[model samples]
Structures are given as C-alpha cells and as structure tokens.
Target: MKSITQLENKKVLVLGLAKSGEAAARLLAKLGAIVTVNDGKAFEENPSAQSLLEEGVKVVCGGHPLELLDENFELMVKNPGIRYDNPMVARALEKEIPVWTEVELAYLVSEAPIIGITGSNGKTTTTTMIADVLNHGGKSGVLSGNIGFPASEVAQSVTNQDTLVMELSSFQLMGIESFHPHIAVITNLMPTHIDYHGSFEEYVAAKWNIQNEMTSDDFIILNFNQDLAKELATQTNAQVVPFSTVEKVDGAYLENGGLYFKGELLMHADELGVPGSHNVENALATIAVAKLSGVSNQAIKETLSSFGGVKHRLQFVDTIDDVKFYNDSKSTNILATQKALSGFDNSKVILIAGGLDRGNEFDELIPDITGLKKMVILGESAPRVKRAADKAGVTYLDAKDVADATRIAFEQASAGDVVLLSPANASWDMYKNFEVRGDEFITTVERLKG
Candidate 1:
C-alpha cells in the first residue's frame, strides 16, 4: 500500500469524488484515515461516483453541507477539478484547516525525488518524454499527473528510490504551499484558464507558483523565449536552466534538424519522437530535466530515438486521399493552437476550434491563422471564436457539437488542406472532458473516412 503515515487514521475529507478524489479516499481509508467524499454532482449523473460509494466510502452527493465540512477533518484532499476558492474549502481554511491537492498529497507520500512538468500546452508531452527518458535510462519513474495515473495512483506503489514524474496543472498548483520537486519545468506559458483564474496575471501567477515554492537545491527548467519564463527564471532562487527551440541557451534547443544542449548536439531534432516544432522544444525540456536528474546523455539520446509521442497531442490519425487529419484535442489553450497552426507549413487549414471558453485572449492568435481556409466551430464560444476568425480574415462555419463540427470539417477540407481539431477552450460544454472530446473527434473522423 502507498505510505500515508502523515494521514493514517486521521479524518480526511475527499472533495469532488472524481478519479483523483476517489483514489485519495480509497487510499486514505486503507491507511486508516476516516474518508468521507463530497461532490456537487448527482451520484447517478457521474458514473465514477457510483463505484466509489459502493467501496464503503461515505458520500454526500448533489450538494455540499455545512456540517460535514466544518473543521472536523484535519486535512482536505481536494480534487483538482474543484477550485481553490471553493466555499466549503474556504470555510475549512477559516478554522486554520489545511487543504491538499491529490498531487501534493502524492508528493508527500513519495520518498523519491520528483520531476514535474507544467505549461499552457505540451506539459503531457514533456512529462511523458522525461519519464520515458528516465525509464529507458534504466531508472524507474512513473508518469502521473494530467497525463497518465493521477499522482495519488503513483503514490500507491512508489518506493523511496523510484522517481516520480508528474504533470502539474494550474488548478493543482493553486493550493500547493510547500510541495517541492527536485526537477521542475514550465514547458511554456500562454493564457489559459482565464475563466477559472479571473485575470491573466492571476493565471500566470498560478503557473509561476510551481517555481515559487522551489528551494535552493531544486532545479527549474523553462522556455527562455517566453517573457514570463525569462522573468521568472531571474527571480527563481533555484538553479534556472533555459531551453529553446529557436536558439541554444545554457540548456537545450534545436538546430538544423537536430537537438542541442548548451551548443552540443544531442540528437537529431528532425527525428524527435513527436511531431511539431513544439515537440522538439518539449524534447529539449525533457532532456534538460533528465540530465539534471543525472541521466546520461547516451540514455537520453537512446530514449528519444525510440519513444513514441503521447496520443491526442498532435496525433495524426489517417490521410484520406491527400488531406491530413490531426487531432489536437490536447490543445486546450489559444497559445497551444497557435503553435499547432505554426507547426504545419500548409497555407490553408480547416481549423475546428471552440469549446467551453476559458477567458483566453483570442487576439494573440488572430493574425497567424489567415491560412485558416474555414473553421467549423463548436461548443459555447463558437460565435466568439467565429468573430475572432472573422477579424483575422478567415472563412468560418458553425456546428453545435464535436461530431457535427468534425463532419463539417471533413466537407470543408480539401486534398491538400489540413484539418485540425485544436479547441482553444476547455472541453466541458459538450463532453465529459478533453479526452472524451478528443476521442469523439477521432471517432467522427474515422466515420467520415468511411
């Protein structure tokens, strides 16, 4: 069982009964912590909650209660989906109660050093790549966080010597106070979760918080080209390593179809396991993290040559005749979509963009997507996204859902054009989550092919 000595036999409240929430509850219960779950959604509506309640987890469904959460529990293991400013959690804080994200909880239980990845996009790519590099280098590290297993899941089985590789989201970082990883990376920053964060500064502050909590012995790797990253690097007390795709720095970067670390060629950049210049940058970031962790350059090179990229983050499905169909369901922010659009050399692209709008500024992406042959938009921000496209001088179409938008996307795309499902918003309006949204896009594309 995962070590929960700090929380063992203690009263803990697991908020939001989602995957991570339930996982925390189950582990805590096994460790003798009294676990009670609370979620705002109906038990029947959320399939995950049904199974969780069946496991002897006392659950409060549909709404929160003032009594169950009133400082009775010593610690609150919060699901990342729930906001930091959530009323119930706020109430607990009034009494000096502590709140911990599932990720932070995982960090405490882990006796091993950790590698953390955070960014507007490509965090999963970098996280997976870095973990893969470690594992391939004959070291053991688990891929967890916004990518694979939740950190709670990783904590259940890790040993003191094993490495913990995590992808940290802005939400998960929101509640973190002192949780530190030996190696931390912010792949890049772009305006994301503007709705959840109130302002762009607040959003950036949350992203910067990962580095903010680092101590002197900790190592931070960042994209030097991003102004926010550069500014943060100067201010960080930890050892700051700067990585780039366009230029070489004190760390990794790309050269003529090859990757370089501080001017030394490490691997062929053109042969990076993932597609896009973004992945090249991700590879650079991952390599830099691994090297800092003491992984040899030879192992890093070997891993990059053989590792396949993560699915849904620029995953190319199939080409029907001449058009390429790419699923960037992982592109949950405008900046990520901008990188995706820039990665391709095509002059014309049928961009399927829109989802639950997250307060991202569409202005930054307005100019470059002129090659957007036509955009078949979906979800809550369709009209807003259409207007952005209109202002950018691109043709536009509207659809009500992912499937409908993809259907329209197929019809609008031509032999030489690229069809991209890079929604610059969250995936809650028409789907359960981003994975569901991405899966539905691929399924619809396969149906269109037939």
Candidate 2:
C-alpha cells in the first residue's frame, strides 16, 4: 500500500458500520485522521463501533443525530447502503463536505492498479473470471469490493506487483471522487436498484462515476450489445475495448461460432465451462481483461474452460432422480431471473421465485415465462409474481419458504426437468442475503437426496 498523507489530522465522519464502514474508519484513523463513527445501532449492540471507540476514535451510536454534521468534518465516508437522501448525508452535501464510500479509500491507499467491474448484472461473475484468469497466468489478482470482501481491507495489503480486481456497485460508485481504476469493466446496463437510486438514470450516472478520473492511458471494457455502453465509450477518456456476443468487434467478440480477441481465435463459444449466453458475454469481457493484462491465451482458455461459476448464481446443485436443481439465489432482479431462465429450456423448468417486493411489478417477466412448466412463488412478492404468472398462462403455486419451494419444485419436476431457484427479487423480506437464500435451497436439495 502507498503511504498517503492526505488524511493526516483531518476530521472525518464515518457513517454506518458495516465491513466497509469499519474498514474505512480504521484506515482513516491509521492515516492520522480524527475519525468519528456514527451508527444507527445502539453503542452496546455495535461491536465494530465499540472497537473503534476503544482505539480512540469518537463514536456516536443509537441514531444519526443531525447535529453530528455540525462538527466541521472535512469528509464523510458513508456506508454504500446508506441513502444519499439520509439526513446526515444530505446535510453533509449541503455543507459541502465530501461524501465517499470505502472504495475511494481503497484507491487512495493501494499501490497496485485496480480493475473495477460494475454493471446491473454479471459483476461478480466477470470479476471472478478476470481474477481467476489473471492468477492462472502468474499475475497476482486480489478480489475485493461488493463481491463480499471490503475493498479498503484488500487494497491495504496489495503491493504494486499485484492487481486489485474489485466488484463495484452503483451505490459505492456514487460516492467516489478520485477512485479511478486502471481497467474498468461495465458488464451491461439494466434498470435496477430504483428504490435506492431513485431512477434508472441516477443509477446509470452513479455507475458512470467509476470512470470519473480515468485518462487516455486507462482502458474501459464495454459491452457492444448495449446502446448505453456504446454511448459510454464515446464519453470516457479511457481507450474503449468492446466485447460482444452478437457480432465482431475490435476487441473481444464471438464470430463464426468461436470466441476471438482482436481477431485471434481464443476458443469455441460452446467450450466455456459455464452455461448461458450471459456467461459468454461475461467471458468475452474477461478475455478482454486477460489479454490486456498480457495473460497467455492458454491460461485464459484453461480458466474459462474449468471455471464452474460463482456460488448463488446459476450454481448447479445436484440431480435427484434425473431432475437437475440450480441455485440461482443471487438473481435478485427481474433482468437476472430473465437471464437465468434463458439458459435453460423453459418448458422443462420448474422455477421457484418471489422475494422482497421492491415496488415493481413482474410484468417484465411474462415474456420470459412463455414455456415454463410451473412456478413456485414465495415471500412478499408472491401475489405480484402470481399475477404475472397468471398473465403468462403458466401454472403457479405458493410456498411459505425456500424449503417448501424446493420440495414443491422437486415434486412438480419430471425426469429431465430442472428445478431452478432463481428468485427475481431481493431476499431482505425472507433471508439476510442471497447467499443465505441459496444455502437454504442447497440444504433442502441435499435433504431430498437423503
């Protein structure tokens, strides 16, 4: 990590105390900043804030007292999940105090160049692919950001010889200033997080922030298939390397049934270990990064050929009586579920869906439901999902939980059918996160085997 003296003696406010917030607070304190951490959780209940207090950082807990902003703080490193309209955040903005997410801190401290990956979907898979292929080619690639590990924590440990492969989210990007990555990848654009971002335009604007400080020397890998991505290419100073599954591009693309990078054939399109055209797009993006990093085509080929895909994302569980089960619990939005459904023969899919009702209808999913055999709906969005299913003329059932959904899907599945758990909404209404939701599905599937 680079030794940066910019924060020395600066009064910084860290709002919220998730892994990112805690890491940012600690890192700021280490840099001689007078750090103050505020969390909505009560002091006794917030272990991270308590620990920071023990280390001499000021702690304000129980609630976000608006008066905290009167402290004349120079910067506020907020938890990405915290809304910008949050009183403290809004007040800070009004007062002209810079607000940032921990990702900015990651950029400030890391000696290594970062490869930031962000999009509506496929960020995790693309980040994982680039990291894996880089590592396989003798390049040091550390995974961080929204993929689970805090970018602040990972950045501090990586040296100039390593590459930080970060999975950035629009929320985190919305808070960046000088957090520029040497290589940036936007997997694709879609309308999502409308609740948090307020609109698709705002969300897209936030994602665009990933390239705020990029220059001509940098590279931004874009999706040629997306009009928004193509438009973005013309706006960034970074050299645009396009990836597409539809037609040939100057960079990575598929042509004549083979994946090619800059006119050189890498592998057959069907040779990728993971299924789906979405995975193919992800692979094209990965190939662009790999080739840019000087990774051998053989290493890229080997990694892509064996990469089984990320957990909770179209993950193959096990087959029971010739009926296959897939755990795609990470599909928290309609577009994701659509992509997941596109990977299988819909006529043979017994889909288990429904979760948090994010104030959006499932009408968009009707087109994708044309051939599904059955849909097992659950959680808060069941009624809405059932409405869409009804409109699509697909058979539907309701389940109380993942266990019930899994059992019902299995029962409905005939030999050669797929029991897919790809909830098209957030799991906050029923589970802590998608991983937990996927885990429950896997556990129930295992029980079915027993």
Candidate 3:
C-alpha cells in the first residue's frame, strides 16, 4: 500500500461520524494527521466520535460550528451524506480547501487495483457478482464502499495482489478527486436522488464521476440500453465496453436466451439464479469485468449460476400458504420499483409500496402497476402513490407501515400469487435505511407464516 506520509502533520477536518467518516478519521490519526472530527450528533449519542476522542483526536459534537472552518485545516473529509450546501462545506470550498470523501483517502493509500461500480440500480448485485467471479477464479476480491464495508477500511488491508471491488454511490463519487478505478462499471443511469442533487442532470453527472480519473489503460463497462451511459463513452479516456439486453454488440449481449461475449456464447440466460432482465444486465456487466480481470469463462458461468443475488434486492423471503413473498425494499426509486414489478407476471402480483416522497411524482409508475392484482401503500408517500394507483385503475389499500402493508397484502393475496414489497421511495422517513426496511418486511412475513 502507498505510504500515507503525505498526510502526516496536515490539519484535517472530518465532518459527520458515519461509517465512512469514522474510518477516515481513524486512518488520518494513524497517518499522524491532526484530525478534528465534527458531527451533528451529540458526543453521548455519537459512538463513532467518542471512539476517535479516546484515540487523542479532537472531537467536536452536537453541531457544526462555523468557527471550525476558521481553524485553517488544510483539508476536510466530509461524509458523503453531508452535501456541499452545508455551511461548513461551502465555507471550506470558498477558502480553497479540498473537500473529499473517505473514498478519496482510500484511493490515495490503496495498493490494489480497484473496480468501481455505480448506478441508480443493480450496483450491489453487479458488484457482489464481480467479486464472487474473481474469488471463484482464485483471486482475492475485497468488496466494500456503499455495499456495507467502508472503502477506507477495506483499502487499509488490501495489497497489490488483491482486487478492491467497490459499490460507489453518486454521493460518494461527488467527493472523489483522484479516485480512479482500473475497471469502472456503470450499470445504467436514471434520474435519481433528485432530492440530494436538486436536478436530474446533476445526478447523472455525479454517476459519471466514476470515470473522471481513468486513463486509456483503464476499462469502463457501460449499458448499451441507456443512452446517457452510452453517451459517456466519449467523455472518458478509458476503453468502453458496452453490454446490451436488446441487440448484439461488440461486448456482452443477450441473444437467443444465451449470454454472449464478443459473439461467443457464455451461458444460457435462464441458468442465471437471479430473476428479471435487469439482472441480466447486471450479469452482463459482471461478465465483462470478470473477463477483463482475466477470469475464465467457466468461473464466470459458475458464479452466475450460483449467485442468488444480494439481499434486500428481489430477495425471496418465503412462501406461506402457497403465496410467494419478495422483499425488494432496496427499490428506493421509481425506476427500481418499475424494474422489480417487471420481473413477475403483472396479474399475479400484489405490490406493497410507498415511503419518503422525495417530491417524485408517481404518475410515471402508473403503467408499471397496471397488471398488479392489488397495491398496498404505506409510509410518507402513501397518499401520492395512492393517487397514481387510482389513475392506473389498480385497486390499492392504505396501511400505516410495512407491517400493516405486509398483513394487508397477505390477506389480499391468494395461493399462486406474489406479495412484493418494492417501495419506490426511500425509507429515511420511516426507518434507518433500506436494509432495515427490508428486514422488517421479512420479519413481518415470517411472523405471519409462523
């Protein structure tokens, strides 16, 4: 790994003591940087900040004071969730101080080749699949970033022999300066996180940041079906490899029920354990990354057939009374929910949806719900989603929460029906994150089954 000596004695400010923030602060301290951490949560409530304080780092809690900016820190490692609009962040930018995310620090010290994947959907599935493919091929592949493990923590342990496969979000990408991945994959870009980015154009631009530092020697896998992704080919110096579900291309393509790479059949599309054509796209991207990483076709096929998919993503919870229940709580956007619904035959589905609104109009989701047998709405966006369901002429019921939604859906569903929990909105209004939201749905389903 590269030595972090450059950061030694540099004054660094860490904002927000989230997972990434904690790791960055600890790493900075280890590198002998004067690390001062500021978190909005009080010291008693912020365990991460408390840990840093025990290590002799300066910990400021309860709020982000403007005085912190006057400390003349050389750099600020702000949490990805802390937007540029934050007063401190804006002030830091005004003072010409570099504001970075934890990923930037990880990249600066990491010795391993990195494979970064980003998109509005299917990033987790594709990132996990790529790591699995490499591992099956007898290579050490470390998974991190937005998938759970902080990239900063993963980078510390990875060596030149290992491959760091990261699931990057646009939020994480925005904070990167020189963070470049050897192999970058953009599964597909959609208008998402409008709440954070303030516009669709800005969101798309953030996802494109994955390739910002790539050179010709690097490789970028793009989705042929997404024009926005395809248009990015000219913007990067990296070699572009496109994967398509519609037509054959020079890269990976799905034709005649088989996945083909550069005109050679790799595996039958049906052999893939994950459902949905979106997953086919995810698999194709994984295949491209595996092949580029020197993994054998056999290993790729083996991983594809065995990889059931990541949790909270079209995960099959259980079948009680012959009704199949699926937890897709990770579908925190309109397009994701549409993709989830497309996986099953429309008429056999009873969908449970609604969550943090994010000001997204559900009118676009109307057509996707046309085939649903029933719809159960809950959380903050229930009223908005209910209006869309009404517009689509789909029968829907109102519920107070996921538990209520699950009970109502199960009651409305019959044998041979699918009860799907695919909230098109985020869980921030009702729960901690999508994982917690999904777990609650699973717990509720299991209780009913018992």
* Total backbone collisions for each predicted model: 2, 0, 0
Q: What are the TM-scores, per candidate, against the unseen true structure?
A: 0.68, 0.72, 0.72
Off by over 4 Å in 1: 1-4, 44-55, 309-450
Better structure of 1 and 2 per TM-score: 2
Candidate ranking under TM-score, highest first, comes to 2, 3, 1
Per-residue lDDT of 282 in model 3:
92
Q: Write the per-residue lDDT of candidate 1 for residues 417-438, one digit (tens) a residue.
A: 5788899888988888888998
lDDT of 3 by residue, 85-181 (tens): 9899999999999999999999988999999999877777788789899999999999888765678888999999999999898999999889999
> Tens digit of lDDT per residue, candidate 2, span 10-54?
999999886678889999998899999998978865666778888
Full-model lDDT, candidate 3:
0.87
Model 2 misplaced stretches (Cα beyond 4 Å): 309-450
- Candidate 2 all-Cα RMSD: 13.3
Name the Cα RMSD for model 3.
Answer: 13.4
Question: What Cα-based lDDT does every candidate model obtain?
Answer: 0.77, 0.89, 0.87
Model 1 / residue 292 / CA error / Å: 2.0
Which window of 10 residues has the lowest lDDT sum in candidate 3? 339-348
